[model samples]
Structure formats: C-alpha cells, structure tokens
Target: MRNRVSLSNRLKKVASYLPENANFADIGSDHAYLAAYVCQNDPNAKAIAGEVNVGPLNSAKDTINEYGLENQIEVRLGDGLEVIRPGEVNQIVIAGMGGSLITSILNKQKNISLEVDRMILQPNVDAKELREWLDDQNYMLIMEEIIEEQGHIYEILVAEKCNSHQSPYSDLEKEKQLYFGPYLLQDRNDAFMKKWGGERDKLTRVVEQMKQARQMDRDKIDQFINELDWMQEVLNNEKNNMETR
Candidate 1:
C-alpha cells in the first residue's frame, strides 16, 4: 500500500477558503494532501507542508515526492509556524489540531500577523477560546463555517490581520458570538444550530446534576446554571431567527 489516505469534503471546504493566486502554508501537515490539492487545483498557487513529528514529516515528504510536486510543495519538519520564514506565504492553514494548541501556536508566532495576509484555522474544540484570542490580537473575523463530517461538527475560521476595529462585538454579542460563531450566528445553518443545540442540552443535564448534588458548592452550581441559561437563550435566538427568515 502506498500510504492510502484522502481529504474529506469538509477539509476541501476548508481549503476552498484560501484565496486564489496565494502562497499558502499548511502547518502540521500530516500527509501533505491539502498542499498537493491546492497546488494541483490552483495554477497560480504554491504551498509548503510543515510537520513537526518525524513520522508525519516523513510521510509528508513521501507524499510530496510521490506526487512529483517537490518544486511546488516544500516539506519542513518543525513545530507550528517555525518551519516557514517570515513573508514566505500569504495564507496559512492550521487544521486537525486542538483549539488551545492552535491558539498557542498563533500566540507564539505573532510575527505571522505582520508577515501573512490571512489565516484559515479549523479547531477541534474550545473554538470560543480561539475566537477570543483572535479578537485580542486584533484579527478580524472575515468568515466562519460549521461543517458536519463523520457525525461531528467542525468550525473553520477565516480571519485577516487588523489594527482598528471595535471589540469582536458588543458585550452580550461577544459572549454569544464566541460560543456560537459570528458568521454562523448570522448564517444559521443546520449544522450550526444542531451543534449549539446539542451543547445546550448537555449543559442542561450537567446543571441538573449539579443542582441535585447536595455536596456541590453553591457558587459552582450557580455558575453552571448561568452558563446553561446563556446557552439556552442563544439557541432559542438562533431558532427564532431561522424560523422568521
């Protein structure tokens, strides 16, 4: 077997967010499939595949060589953004990673803000933290997408560097937008609603459990109840918007 693997339609949808004619980098590129796809599909684009782990790095190198794209795709073995020199690529795609790891990578690689034109990120969880990090760094949220694949919902964020803008949203809007994506809130897609609704239901169960536990701290129980309420309100708002529209 020649290391058989393929990109899912969801990954392709994330790749579609990249601009045409852009130089791109895929950080943590395990098999280099996305980089190869971009190079073959977009004539004006070039890509770099950066992998930190030895196994994955070798796999990426083999994939690039097998595809005869050595000239179009550069494979480097280093952590996060360390593989790419400043200004080497305009668009950076970091996917298949946890939200906290992704945020930490971006936080440590602040040089990318000055070097790259845009960032396309797909976080596995804690998307609110990643969005809050982007807001703190003055990055503008250009687009947000939620896709369901293999019975799971993934959020992809497309952002651009910016210096002047109001905070991510008004105080209430910020909380709701961070928990549910800003664009997804406006789009009100089925996947988005389903994901948030499921989360709300889970939180409701947790709140009920906390309330019934006689030993539970009052403060902690109150906090859980508050979160459950917020999630319920947000979900209801999304549902109402969808129905009216």
Candidate 2:
C-alpha cells in the first residue's frame, strides 16, 4: 500500500543505504517521500518525518495517510533534529538541502547527532563543508555515492560514529577527500566525472569573465584558480588511468 508513493532516483540511492530494520528520522522530509518509501519497503522500519515548516509538515501527514503508513511513519513539525529526542532513532536522513545548512542543523542538535547510529546526508551544494563538519564531529565516512538523474548530479554521504569504524580520510589525502569525497574520488564513476567536468567548465567561464572586470577580485580569482588546478589534476589522472586500462 505504501508503495504508491514514487521516489526519484536520487532518493532511491539514499534509501539503499538504510539498514534492514531502521528506526529513523527524516529531517527536512519535504512531503516525506523518503520516509514513506523506506517504511513501505521495510516492514520492520519506523520513521519520523520532520519538517520545520507547517505546510510541509501537513503535506507529510497527507503522504503518510495516503499510503496508510500513519502507524509506521509519524509526521512532526519542528526545526532540524528537535523533531525527535536523542536516542529515539538509530538513523537520520537529511537530504535536498545545502551542506552548510545541514551542518548547522546537525550542530544545533549535537545530542541527537551523537546518539544516532548512522547519518545519510545528501547536500545540494557545498559538500566540502559538510565533509569537514563530519570529520570535526568524529563521524567517520563509511560510504559515498554519486548519481546523475534528470540532468542533475547528486552525492550521498553515509557516516557512522568514529568509534564504530576507522576514518577514511588521511592527512595526505584529507584536503582532496574533503573537496571530492574519498570514496567517490576513488570510484571516479561517469557521474562523478560529469559533475566535476561541468563545474570546471563553469569556473573557467567565470574566471575569464572576472579577468575582464574593471577591478578584479584577486582573492576570489586566486581561489578559483586553485580549484581549477586541483580539478585539472584529477581529470588528468583519470585520463591516465583510463588509457592504461
């Protein structure tokens, strides 16, 4: 019955990371599509759809009711992790938001953040910031995935408490891993290449445009140049690997 709700490919990828019998919270659940989909698939799963805004909260309720998953998925109206108490859920999912915002949300509820067994984050942008936050908070990256759908590319980061496993980032590769996810960089799948390739092209155009300005933003230009250099190195290395293969 709950299978009536359709999820996008990106959400499907996020859902794949969930455990078999998860008691989770979907923060910023926006219509609760993910919560509904997961609960429908896992009979043992229970979820809370947390939405900060009233409208989305109501929409989430509608979805739960439509799928007759009201018993399995509860809709809550609150900001970020405040929707659920610490230790109430073992896993949390925060998707379709900017990295900085997601970090802020996690920071605001450090207690709940620490208690959760796992977190699956899908940041729309500034993924580097999120990765850095995860490192600082001692959440080790367990898995990372990149997918392209409907002309858009998305990244999913799965992390667990540092004590649960080893940290994937090393001092030598830390910087690069934070910018381009450790697992994703190692994979360098078609989607990863496409996403970074597009970003590199966009930066090239911006750098040229900036040079033509009456007064250049030297600092910004320098930053963009550094990013371009790093991107070029990754692209060239991938090319070399492909040729050898």
Whole-model lDDT per candidate: 0.83, 0.91
Per-residue error at 218 for model 1, in Å?
Answer: 3.6
For candidate 2, the lDDT comes to 0.91
What would the per-residue lDDT of candidate 2 be over residues 1-245, giving only the tens digit for each residue? 22467999999999999999889999999899999999888889999999989999898998988888888999988989999986799999999999999999999999999878899999999999999988888888899999888988899999988674467888898888899999998999999999999999999999999999999999999999999998999999999999999
TM-score of each: 0.89, 0.94
Weakest 10 consecutive residues of candidate 2 by summed lDDT: 162-171
Candidate 1 versus the native: TM-score? 0.89
In model 2, residue pairs whose N, Cα or C atoms come closer than 3 Å (at least 3 residues apart or on different chains), thus clashing, are none
Model 1: which residue pairs collide? Answer: none
- Where does candidate 1 have its weakest 10-residue lDDT segment? 1-10
Question: What's model 2's lDDT at 17?
Answer: 90
Which RMSD does model 1 reach against the true structure?
3.0
Best by lDDT: 2
Candidate 2 wrongly placed segments (more than 4 Å): 1-3
